[model samples]
Target: MAANNLRGQVLSLYSRLLRMSRNWNATNPAETIVERQYIKEETMELFRKNKHHSEPFIIKECLKEAEARMTMAEHYRNPYPRPVNLPKRSFSKKEGKKIGKAIQKFNEQSRPIYIRSTDDAVGRSS
Candidate 1:
């Protein structure tokens, strides 16, 4: 499916990024680091430009190559924000049904809301 291909592409891209980061870390020389970063940025940019037409196989292969270059030293940063201890929103089915019924009743009693076609709406504005 198209969704599966999209997921694969994203996963591959992340894997490739991690690998390149590891390789850059391993070299440690200033010039190599800069070059590596530049190359990685370029690769990401190219991917962004042509992502619409990119095949799943190409994405997966690129990711595998990138992963091969990755190192443990490059993995220390936290990829996610610290978890917030916020209370979760809870809603019951009965509450949802009640709200839906109320909205339906209000809509039925009110004048119909008209949404003009995009071209008609734009022409009226002009």
Candidate 2:
């Protein structure tokens, strides 16, 4: 927040912009890659162009503008913040027709693991 530390503040903002940009995973891999590269190039260019600025007031204004750009990129650039949900294929669909097999369902109560005693009727909880 200090006017004298504009350099550090801008650098922090730049890093944050890059970090948040990586989280964007649109339906297409190419789009995400392009957007990420754009964020990096844009941020670097903006900071590099204003590196020689010495006026505290100008520097403060520049940082504010950079912060606003970062905010817009974070919220507006990517309409979908959460990752795209991919559809899952069933076991039969994944494997070829030759190897396709249906999932098996089993009843545990019918298994031999359970033992019924002669007191089955007398031991009834009801």
Candidate 3:
């Protein structure tokens, strides 16, 4: 099954990351300790946090991101994640308060909701 394959991939990637953390060799002597600790902590935190997710596309995206990060680290000889340039948002105080309330309401929803991917639809209908 596809889920089984994804599970295997996740386990393999997790083990690889753990091993990498233990064996990390930094190009910059000053960054060795910081980068190693970061790799281990980030790996543990992100994997544990997302372990409960059942969405196949979400899992695949995470796996791709991890692989890309690993490749980038090897190429750059840096284990830390690259800084993202997020766009700045400028909301008025009133708008910000309203947005905050909306976010809180969304988070407090009682039931979990998921959008089924096309793959799920096709597989289930067969």
Candidate 4:
């Protein structure tokens, strides 16, 4: 759970940095390029460190973001191919049904705690 939180923090920071770069580009074109490059390098380094620990969704997002940014940085490099093909795995119907039931059971057990935590978070944030 602690590791997941840390990974979330890193992902949030990366997203913020990307937004800042886009904003900078619009307002300060000359400075934006340099700043963007610096941010890209820093983000790449941080991402590499946490890559193995990243969740599936985050890893996908990171790869997509990196490819987009790299294409922008190196225009001469051929445009990235559409529909990056990630490897797929298959499971039997029995396995799927078992997994679904397990998830449902877990959610049913944790729903109250999850709601309380969410309420607490909202109350604190506000």
Q: Tens-digit lDDT track for model 2 on 1-126?
A: 465477778778778877766776645676988777766776666567667777777676566655655564566665322232222432322354444223221221221211111114222110
TM-score between model 4 and native? 0.32
Worst 10 residues of 1 by lDDT: 111-120
The true-versus-predicted C-alpha distance at residue 78 of model 4, in Å, is: 31
All candidates' lDDT scores? 0.43, 0.52, 0.67, 0.46
The sequence of per-residue lDDT tens digits that candidate 4 reaches over residues 1-126 is 755665675667578656655544423455657666665665556465546644555554444545454454345332222232222432223643555665444443443321221233222111
Sort the predicted structures by TM-score, highest score first: 3, 2, 1, 4
* Predicted candidate 3 versus true structure: per-residue lDDT over 40-59, tens digit per residue: 98788768766877889878
Better of 1 and 3 by TM-score: 3
Candidate 4: residue pairs that collide:
none
Flag regions of model 3 displaced more than 4 Å: 85-126
Query: Per-residue lDDT for 39 in model 2?
Result: 64
Q: Which numbered prediction scores highest in lDDT against the true structure?
A: 3
Count of clashes in candidate 2: 0
Supply the TM-score for candidate 2: 0.52
Show the lowest summed lDDT stretch of 10 residues, model 4.
117-126
RMSD of each: 18.4, 25.0, 10.1, 13.8
